[model samples]
Target: MPVSPTYRPEPRFFDLGGEYGDPVRAADFPETRLRFRNDRAAATVGLETLTDAEWIAHFGRFVPLPGQPGPVAMRYHGHQFRHYNPDLGDGRGFLAGQLRDDEGRLLDLGTKGSGTTPWSRTADGRLTLKGGVREVLAAEMLEAQGVPTSRAFSLIETGEALQRGDEPSPTRSAVLVRLSHSHIRFGTFQRAAYFGRPDMVEALVEHSRSLYHPDLAEGDVPGFMRAVVEASARLTARWVAAGFVHGVLNTDNLNVTGESFDYGPWRFLPYYEPGFTAAYFDQTGLYAFARQPEAVFWALTQLGGALKLIADAEALTEALNGFGPAYIRELRAAFLSRLGVKSLGEAADQRLLDTTLALLREGGEAMRWEPLFHDWFGGFASSARALSGPRATLYQSKVFADFRFSLFDHEPDRPERLEAAPFARPEPEEMVIDEVETIWAAIDGGDDWTPFHEKIARLRAMGAARNPTESP
Candidate 1:
């Protein structure tokens, strides 16, 4: 990694004082080996001054930054799978540091599996190295796909073996650093509500708004709801269009900034099945691919309930009601963006979008998510050669006729880029369960990172091509 001249540290989150959390210490590990360091993200906050050894020490040892306060595990309560869980808080993680980036946004440096706090309960507060690796891949892929998400800023393998039932026993342990916009979750407010501390809830709203929603009116919970609702809608739409199932939509996981983070049991659809779920335990399909929008809306409603102490109930309800329409509009735009097609106005665009999804749905279990957009990305003209490939017979079906007609209404976006070589590959990049296991297998068996690194390269390339330059 090249060192830049702009290495500075700012710890603004500590200025919030002790109301949000209690001070916690990082666990002492036997050793720390640097596994991943996000150069782009590090440069954004000017953290390159720290050597790799220093980086591991700072992240691994939980040492306070220069002139910074003690690290705190934030206090909050959340609904887990629809049931209110008052015991919930940051169990294995805590906000370690904060900084101001080049873009002038306040970013947080938080740790996962660093050690246990008051909420650790009976569980061991250690992270598997494999889990750390998975989070790195998840954050990178999601960010590349344009989802507002937290980045895995650093990953370091701790020299310890931890036993767990989910995977093989005695898995290698590690600690991860995540850089994100805010750590204030919806449950942050809910915690205040649970304690009947409306004043604290209002204080949190003011604090977060002054940082993230500076333009909005002060102490206006309804206005805050509108901003959060729009952002959440955009985020949920991104997940759906990207064929992502977050698996856990627990209230605690839904941060107020609407960015996706804390990846566990996350999966990209192998096929465009609405019922597909990432978590094996999600047998009831509560957080399935298709129901993600509904889940987000429900979470927003819960947030609205929490704000009833300060905001007008009717106005909050009105803001919450906007989610359905906002979700529809955002979902359409997200799908359009994924298809790399220029919108020909709402009616025609909706027709194109509907037809495309209809075809995917009709293709059923046989149709994969990425390839449909990958193959016919910019419509028939762009995918002519790809249509000649093995899956040609599937697209040749009568189910695609409307989608074919909708193509006449608009031109392909950046046709020149589509004409360039990379999009013509036989297969689109996918991140399903099997591929995840394959990457982990390479790491487990041979200590090789070739496949993992190459996968990131490919996903980054796909992101460059798939992301739209023109705003919707």
Candidate 2:
């Protein structure tokens, strides 16, 4: 394999000992077909130099990278849909390797549907091809929306048929490799505490703090908890601003790095409906679009509870209490960023956000979420442009009057962005369920990848237009 000079492999998780994970082998599939490869993410870890065959040999064949450890199925217990499940762990995937990016930040190369582990229970640990495609789209869209999320590094179709109750039986299978900051989840600490292993809890805390939150002092459990709370709050706020519904908010899915991953039944909102849910199984709407903040806070509390084994109860409670205020603060910031406007102080920003939400709620089904922000991206600066746009009639309605007035009070952050090619289009790049199904249909029916690839290109172009300084 041709390795880049900047390649820096660091098998840090392997140092946590056998109790934290189990060494595992990937499944031998009948076929290895590459579906997607994120060269941008690869460049971060110095793996962009590899040829396609070499990339498959490493990622698909599960050949250990130079100076990297083999796949290790991580151990943890999590609360699934508010129910504590001790059997939960890396049932289908493993932490394949770790490496430092160009910025010296540690990143984990984790797999999904690679093979079964000891925690596989009674099911086959393989992912449906549709599931893999959906995840790639979800990750890309979230990233483009400026949400902190895991990048879909590589996706390879494996020649196998798997039965799934959620979809039609005998679905195609694939393996996904996700690039994320850390694989250490809130459940990691919970597992340690559940076992009455205070030492392990302390070790986990130190490991997380040192690797992910290096700003904290040694063994600063309270500070570490506070950092995680703030990061989680920011993540939730971004999701809200992006109108993303992460169907599952389990403790195992929420990681220490606060990057959103493990997309099962995620969806982007068509409008501002609070009760909208992505998963059909979510009959109770526990993880609804509007309830995401509460869900994340609950997950954080579970993490805090696990940390209570080693830290003081008062300190943990104090950290937990910061969630509400932090969420509000980050929400304001996130909304302002998405609206492409400068803040007019906290009070004014709050009013603008309140008015914006009210307008959306009142607009009901008639108003699409992304277009509102897209059309008025530069706030009052783009008024002339928006007024003559397709949704101009709705914008001129009485219900939108307050939001319009409030928006005018703020200055545009990057007014030049309105002149970009993406904004010139009638509609913004959206990943609605209908469009997602359409893209999937192209591949499922005739194996035509043109739509899928074209959608990705358009998405990347939109991302680049929105964030001109960023590398796609």
Candidate 3:
């Protein structure tokens, strides 16, 4: 496979020191295979480029350094499915090293699918090739859609047999290395809270302030909490805007940096249903699309509980109170953008949005999420009504309910142009879980990546055009 000629990764903030601790051995596998890594991801975390050796050095196996401290095993605990688990941390995984990108940002070079750590709890620490592939695809798409996330760097099939619940059989294992701003999660704090380690929680909060929320470092602890709360509110709002349902929003999965990471069983909505759930095991729909704001607020409450160690109790309460207002403002902004409306200050426009949502729910039109948004966009603004297929009638019927959206006034030409617009377009062929396996097969075979790469670049460009202020 031909590699890109030049690449550079942006620096992350986790570069403190190369602390050696417990080095976990990687499990052996028979299907060992090397594939071209995501060069864009390598270039994102300040890596100038990767030669085969550099890639292998970081991912293939764990090598202990002489005179370096042994791997410092981290201890953490968090709520899983709302149940508190006080024992969870790098059980099956370990941090390999911390690297400084050219931009001087510190990025964690961690290995997943490496052998189990003390936290492994009788389970294999290794990840499957399929899991790694889905993660990469998810990271790329989410990032392009303006969501903060971890990027998959390289995925090497380790060739070892491993058993898993989600797959057909014990399969050859794979190793995944990803780049991110921080791997420290809300569960990290939860762990401390679980153990009644107020000092540790405070330390972690201060560490996060220096890393991702430095502006709040000097503020009173309560004020600092408000800053973090607001950041999280906006982040959740963005997730909702993109039609993303993070199936596992466990406390451990929530990052302190407010970046979305740890993808598993995640799915984009086929249509706009506030109650949509992506995880089969989400029996209660606790993390449904419509409940995200409340879920985030609940997570913030947990964060506040942990931060109380460092902040005054009254101050923490005050900070937690700010979550509602911040979330509401961000949610409104996100919905407005989804409609392609420059502004949504008018009473008429608000009524239009409410009525559209009410009508969709009443009609059970959750699968028609995008068209519903389009209906309002074209109806309220007198834009094109180029909807085709059976969906056109759905749009026409609901949109024409108000005299404001008269049939003659609707621009028939607008639908034609809207048909060409790929925004919110969900291709049916790419929706299946199995199609992901095909994508990996193509990548593994060193077949044409031009089409895939081009599509990624196009998405990146589109995201840039829509939200110029978002980080790439």
Which candidate number has the best TM-score? Answer: 2
Better of 1 and 2 by lDDT: 2
Candidate 1 per-residue lDDT, tens place, 220-296, comes to 78899999999999999999888888989989999878999886889888887889898888889999999999999
The whole-model lDDT of each prediction reads 0.84, 0.92, 0.62
Query: Whole-model lDDT, candidate 1?
Result: 0.84
Q: How far is candidate 2 from the true structure (C-alpha RMSD, Å)?
A: 0.9
- Off-target runs (Cα >4 Å) in candidate 1 are 1-10, 419-421, 467-472
Q: Which ten residues in a row have the lowest lDDT in candidate 2?
A: 463-472
Worst 10 residues of 1 by lDDT: 1-10
Error of 1 at 30 (Å): 1.1
Best by lDDT: 2
> lDDT for model 3, on a 0 to 1 scale?
0.62
lDDT of 3 by residue, 214-292 (tens): 7674535676677778878888877876777888887777776667777678877666688888788889999888887
* Model 2 TM-score, 2 decimals: 0.99
TM-score of each: 0.95, 0.99, 0.78
Residue 62, model 3: lDDT of 44
